[model samples]
Target: MKEKILNEAERLFWKYGVRTITMDDIARRLAISKKTIYQYFTDKEDIVYQVVNYHIEHEMIECTRLIDQSMNPLEEMLMISDLMRRNADMVNPSLLMDVQRYYPKAWDAFLQHKEGRIITDIKANLQRGVDQGLYRTDIDLETMARLRVELIQLGFDDRAFPNNKDVMTTQDQLLHLFLRGILSEQGFTVYNTLKNKEYNLTAYENK
Candidate 1:
């Protein structure tokens, strides 16, 4: 029952803005009484908080697994980035839009927490890349890493509006560009090969 309510709430909260959704709406959508929902959650705010927390926890676990340091840093970054882009609908950016649009406090908290975590992750991976000779030296790895991380987040975020289509900078392209900037000659070739590799959905292994 709790899972059902949360699942429905996650959908509703994403489809509609958080402030625009109410307890009654969740109950109605689930075909359950408000009283039943209240048993699991005290109020709409409580549910919203739970939904956000749950999403964050699930994403963090997936992210950690995908960003393994034992693998090549660039490869790790690419695979994790693919996971983020391909799974955006399951991610919280859709719900986060509502938070950003309405709940300023929640938005601020979300940014402070999640963005900080990502920065730390990127910075660490970048430092590892330098140590492993996968990335170039002489550049400020911290700033460049932060920029790449922000670009990835913005790419997935529908909030950053741009007018260009083909030449338009997407998160993937942004990532490639960032990688190109930091790559050694050898790394650059490897990255190009990765980009040109055809994606295969039939067997699901080419990405």
Candidate 2:
């Protein structure tokens, strides 16, 4: 019952931002009473905190799997991008903002994940690319990794991109720019080939 509540709450929170979702909404969706929910969770804040922790754990696992299965660092990034694109619609733009503003514990959990695991994985990816002669050796791994982490969250900043449509496009453009800056000639050749193939496939499907 606790897991069921968490799952439903996660779905609702992802579709509609956290602030708008009340315990009644969750209970109604689950066809359970509010008192039943209260038996498992103390409050909405506790639910949100648990949900955020659950999400981060699953996300890290998926990311690790992607990294392991990818052919190279660039492919790893593209895989991660595809994952984010697929999930973009399910995630409300205001979700992060709501958490940041209203749920301090949840927000801090997210921040810790971002600064710790996410940054570590990004740094590892950069190092792998450099060692493979795909990325420029002169780049500072720490700085670039931190920058990428920031870029991941930048799309949700309403002040910067108000009512932004097409987050995938924004992410793709940012990735292209980031890759161009770090990729070597050999890396660019591989990147361009993959991009051209993607473009051709997109056109073909559109036709």
Candidate 3:
């Protein structure tokens, strides 16, 4: 029951911003009484915290899985980019803002995950790319990694992009730009091939 509530609440929160979702909304969605939700979580804040933690854990595991399965550092990044694109498509533009403004605990947990594990993973990937001669050795790995990490959260800032499509477009453009800056000649060749194939497939599907 607890897991069910968490899953449903996460869905609602992602689709609609967190501040707009009341406990009653969750209960109603689950076809259960408000009291039942209270039994599992003390308040909306608790649920938000739990949901954020759950999301972070799963994201970390997914990133690890991608890393393990990918043939190279660049492939791993593209896979993660696909993951981020899918997540952004589902998420409300104001969701992160709502959590940052209204939910301190949940926001802090997200910050910790972003600053700690995410940055670490990015640094590792950058180093691997450098070692494989895929990325420019002249770049500062730490600074580049941190920049990429912040760029991920920047996509959620509604004030900047305003529209969801604009946000996605900016993110995609920024990612391509970043890759272009970091990729060595050999890496660029591989990236160009993959990107061309992706573009062709997307065009075909849209037709």
Q: In candidate 2, what are the lDDT values of residues 1-207, reduced to their tens digit?
A: 998898889889988889889999999999999999999889989999999998777677767777787788988877777666666657777888889989999999999988878899889999999999999999999999998877767767776777568666776677778888889888887787665333111111111
Among the numbered candidates, top lDDT falls to 3
Considering lDDT, which of the candidate structures 1 and 2 is the better prediction for this target?
Answer: 2
Task: Give the lowest summed-lDDT range of ten residues in model 2.
Answer: 198-207
lDDT of 1 by residue, 111-135 (tens): 7765678778888888877787778
Q: Output the worst ten-in-a-row residue range by lDDT, candidate 1.
A: 198-207
Better of 1 and 3 by lDDT: 3
Residue 57, model 1, lDDT: 71
Each prediction's TM-score versus the true structure: 0.76, 0.90, 0.90
Cα lDDT tens digits, model 3, 1-207, are: 998898899889988979889998999999999999999899999999999998788777777777887788998888788777777677777788889999999999999988888888899999999999999999999999999977767776767667656667778877888889999998998888776333111211111
Each candidate: what lDDT?
0.68, 0.81, 0.83
Report residue 1 deviation for candidate 2 (angstroms).
Answer: 1.9
Ranking by lDDT: 3, 2, 1
Q: How many clashing residue pairs appear in each of the predictions shown?
A: 0, 0, 0
Report the C-alpha displacement of residue 76, candidate 3, in angstroms. 0.6
